[model samples]
Target: MKKYFRSGEIFIWFTGMGLGLSLIMITGLLFLIVVNGKDYFWASELVQITRTDGSKQLGEIVKEEPIPNLNLPDSLWNKGLMRMQMKIGNRDLYGFDFQWIDEREIKNTDLPKFASTIERIEFGNFYGFVKEILVDGDVKVKGEEEIAKKIGSYLDITSSIRNEIKDIEKSKIGKINYNIESLRLEIKKIEFRDKNSVKNKNEIARLESEIAKENRKYEMLKMKVDSLNLLASRYAVYCEDANGRGKTIPMINIVRVYQPNNMSFLEKLGFTLTKIREFIFDDPRESNTEGGVFPAIFGTVMMVLLMSIFTVPFGVLAALYLREYAKQGPLVRTVRIAVNNLAGVPSIVFGVFGLGFFIYFIGGTIDQLFFPERLPSPTWGTGGILWASLTLALLTMPVVIVATEEALTQIPRGMREAALALGATKWQVVRRVILPAATPGILTGLILAMARAAGEVAPLMITGVVKLAPSLPFDSYFPFFHLDRKFMHLGFHIYDVGFQSPNIEAAMPMVYTTTLLLILIVVLLNITAMIIRANLRKKYKSATF
Candidate 1:
């Protein structure tokens, strides 16, 4: 034992044990998340239950658990009794989406082959039998089998028409409105500047003419959309629950309808894949309880990239200056200490600073000078992606500076002398040799910054992040990148769904899924950085020689 202690073997064993325990804990957490969220996409077969009270329930069996504190002689807490959670998702009819029932009261339970699960636009889900397909308030197809056969293909067609209506409303009409707003702003500016001369009036007339044309186009689009909506509303699916409760859902409102009990393994697998795609690619709906999180993903990745763009060059330059050019003195030492201390400051403090300095001071000034026409109603004098990125950049820069300084320090004095002896200037030596050798180290700092930035929520919430953004920062609009736009974030989404949502139980699956996605993204980012660092390390093994 003495020998092992003296040789540090005991410490090594302890360290190894600690690392192993940490890895196990991480794996366990990931497994838990995966298990809980994966069930959200996998189509569970619908089960119909007949209770002792003669009531019938048809829905997915969410889970079952043993009774707590079971008493052998007591009927309420009987030894073998248990309870089950059922996602009886007909919220409009039931006023709730889930139920808990004592297993002892269940008389009989069986998989219902004809039971259909309808994913609707609102009111959660409908689990029942498709009784009729009605068009123009007339029965187009009646009976369960006939409706299933005829309505199968038309639902998909309805979805396409839904997309067309969305494009016409949001994309095309939205652009026209945007253009009209810009023209109005221009007119406002001209009037405010007292430049309403003949030429300006002619310009204004032209602008008004353009606005008139846009209005006419908008009216036409609105008419077309109304007609499409009318056509869509004409078709509806009449469904009945196990207990004979009936509801008519419009074809346009139904996302999908499937008989999960009848689906084969391959069909379920395909269904799972389709759901995964939608989760990754679709915009969230129902206050982010349903649909996809594509917008949040886009915002997160874009913000981190923007933060990196602002962080790397400035961080590297500051580090280089501190290590290579700045005089060694008390002031320099103080700055280094301050930089190190900055990392420990509360993140929300940075958010406050960002809100005050970036948004109010800088953005407000810009809006005043460049966008006076849009005064009071700010273009940039508010929370936005640019300010959010800069705020995070400020928050994470110290790590880069410290890491980069350490990387620069690792290069031997002999290398500097050798470069100098070969007639290389200080700048050339740094640019050519030191930078290449320190590339791996710089990337290490970057990975740390990115991981921290990616998960950060507090600063982002006050700075720019929103629960749901109306539009993404990037589009085909002029200048393409709308840095001044508020955007959604995965971290914020997690916070919202987990805590802020009205129905946390229903939001649980989404919370887990978003959390897992965030972890996956962070891991992928780190892996890419590490891979780059490894290659760079290999290439510059001997000080860029």
Candidate 2:
């Protein structure tokens, strides 16, 4: 034992155990997320259940758990009473999507061959039996197999109309709105210049005329959208619940209709893949409890990239100055200590600071100078992508500085002397020799910073992140990258959908899916950076530097 202790075998065993435990914990967490979240896309068999009172319920059985005992009698303590959670969708009728049923209340349960699930645009999902398909207010199709097969074609028609409506409302009309706002702001600018001057008054009148034209254009687009909606509504799906309660859902409103109990494994797999694709690429709906998170994904990736652009050059310069040029003394040492200590500060404090310093102070000043017309209502004087990126850049600056300093230190003392002997200036030596060799280590710091920034929620919560953004920061508009626009982040999305949402049970799947996506994004970004660093490391390792 003494020999093993001296040889460090005991510590080695301890190290190995710690590493193994860490791997297990990480693997378990990922497994839990996958298990809970993956099933959100996979269709389950619909069970038509009969209660002891003879009332009927139709839904997919979501989960089963033993009832928790709370101040129960001794006889009930070990009774093993179980409850099952059912996603009995018909939100408009029932006012809720899920129900917890006591197992004792279940009189009978069977898979209904005709039972179906309908994904919709409003009131969430509808689970029931299809009674008929309507086109032009007439029953065009009836019967299970016929409705199931023919409904898709009608849905295709309605879906195309819905897409056209969306394009008109969000794109063409949106552009007209943007132009009108700009013209209004231009009038404001002219009034600020000289409210009573002839030139200014004429300019304001011209802008007002332009606004009227834009409004006329908007009305035309709105009319077009309304017509498309009216056309789509002509096609409908009339469905009945287990108890024969009927509801008429227009085909335009219904996203999909499928009988999960009858679906083959291949069909389910294809459905799952298609649903997953939509989740990745669709705009969120139903108060962000359903639909896709493409906006959130775009915001997160864009924010991280902006943060990288902000942090790298400044951090590298500061590190180069400190490690190469600065005199080593008490002041430098104190600065180093401060930088190290900054990393330990609570992230929320940084959020508060960002709100004050970035949004109120700097942004307010910018708005005053550049966008005086949009005052009080604030164009740049608000929480936005630019301010959020800068705040995170400040937060992660210390890590980059430290990493860069370490990298600079690792270059041999003799190298600098040799460069000086060869008539190389300090800047020349740094730009040519030191920087090239230290590239990988500098990337190491950026990798760490990127990972931390990608997962950060607190600072972003107050800085620029929102539950939903009307438009992405990047668009076809002039000055395409709208840095002043607010954004949605995957980290913030998870928190919002998981803890802040009204329907926790319904949103749980969305939360888990967002979490998984966030993890994957961070991993992919880091992997890309690592690949670059590896190639750089290989090139430098082979060099004579």
Candidate 3:
């Protein structure tokens, strides 16, 4: 045993075991997330459940489990009965999306082939049977066959109308409003510069004329939208719930209606894929409980890229100064130690500092100097993508600096001396030899920094991340990338959906899906960085040696 201990074989075994355990845990976690998230998109058969009390319940059986601390009479508890959780998603009628049903109470159940699941604009999903399709306030289709045939046409019309409305509101009307706001700001600027000058007055007059023209155009668009809405409102679908309660839902409000029980495996698979696509591409709605997270994905990528842009150069420069230029002394050692310690600081502290220094001080100064006309409203003097990126850049700078310094140190002193002896200046040696050799290490630091920044939610929440951003940072506006705009983030989106949602059960699937997406994104980024690093290492290895 003493010989084995001295040989360090036990320590090696322990280290290997620990690493293996870590890999297993990580793989298990990823498997769990995939299993839970992927099924959320698949269409499950609707079941009509009949209880002992003669009450009817309908929904997809989402989950079942043995009751924890089973509360039952002694005789009943002995049976070890399990409980079933049903997704009775008629939120508008039931006021909840889920329900817990005791197994004993469920006397009978059957998969209802005619049962339909309606995806709505608000109040979550509605599970019911199609009773009638009313066009122009008359029951045109009553039977299931007739309703199914005309339902597709009605849905197509509604979809077209919805697209038109979206275009008018988001594109045409939005542009007009943006132009009007710009004109207002310009007039304000003119008034601030010269309150009563002829040039100021003429500029203001011209802006007002432009605003009036835009407003007229906006009104015409609004009128057309109202006409489309009226046409859409005329078509309605009446549905009857499992409890025999009837509700009339407008065609415009119903996103989709599907008979899940009747669907073939291929049909279900296609529907699942379609839903997954929508989740990836669509904008989030229903307070982020429903729809896609495209904005969050966009914001996260944009912020990380911006942070990299800010952090890389400064970190590299600082490391170069410390490693190559600074004299070896207690002060330099202390500075290095401080930089190392900075990595341990709480991320939220950096957020507070960013809020105070970047937003309040620097941004406020910029606003006062350049955008005085927009005073009290605060353009830059608020949480925004720019500040958030800068904040994260500051937070991750130490990592880069340390990695770069280590890389610089690894480059042999003989190489530096050789370069100097060959009539190369210090700058030339560093730019040509040292930096090229250190590219792989620099990228390693960048990968680490990006992984950290992408997953960080606490720092982002106070900096510039919001539950929902009205518009993307990039747009058709001049100076297209709006660095001053607030943005969404996947990390914050997970936190919000997991902890802050009104419907925990409804949001749980979304939380898992978003988590999986974030993991995939981080992995993709790291893989890309790793590829670059590997290429750099291969290219420079011979030169370094």
1-545 per-residue lDDT for model 1 (tens digits): 78878999889999999999999999999999998898779998999999999999999888898878543346555465788999999989998889998877899999978899999988878999998898889998987777767787779778888999999978999999999998899888887787658988888888889999999999999999999998888889889999999899999999999899989999999999999999999999888998999999999999999999999999999999999999999999999999999999999999999999999999999999999988889989899999999999999999999999988988888888999999999999999888988888899899999999999999998999999999999999989999999999999999999999877788889999999999999999889999999999999887643
What are the TM-scores, per candidate, against the unseen true structure? 0.97, 0.97, 0.98
Query: Tens digits of per-residue lDDT for model 2 on 216-279?
Result: 9888888888888888878988899999999998888888888899899999999999999999
| Candidate 3 Cα outliers beyond 4 Å, as residue runs | none
Count of backbone clashes, every candidate in sequence: 0, 0, 0
lDDT agreement of model 2 with the native: 0.91
How does candidate 1 fare on TM-score?
Answer: 0.97
Arranged by TM-score with the best first, the candidates are: 3, 2, 1
Which pairs of residues clash in candidate 1, taking residues 3 or more apart in a chain or in different chains? none
Question: Ten-residue segment with the worst summed lDDT in candidate 2?
Answer: 69-78
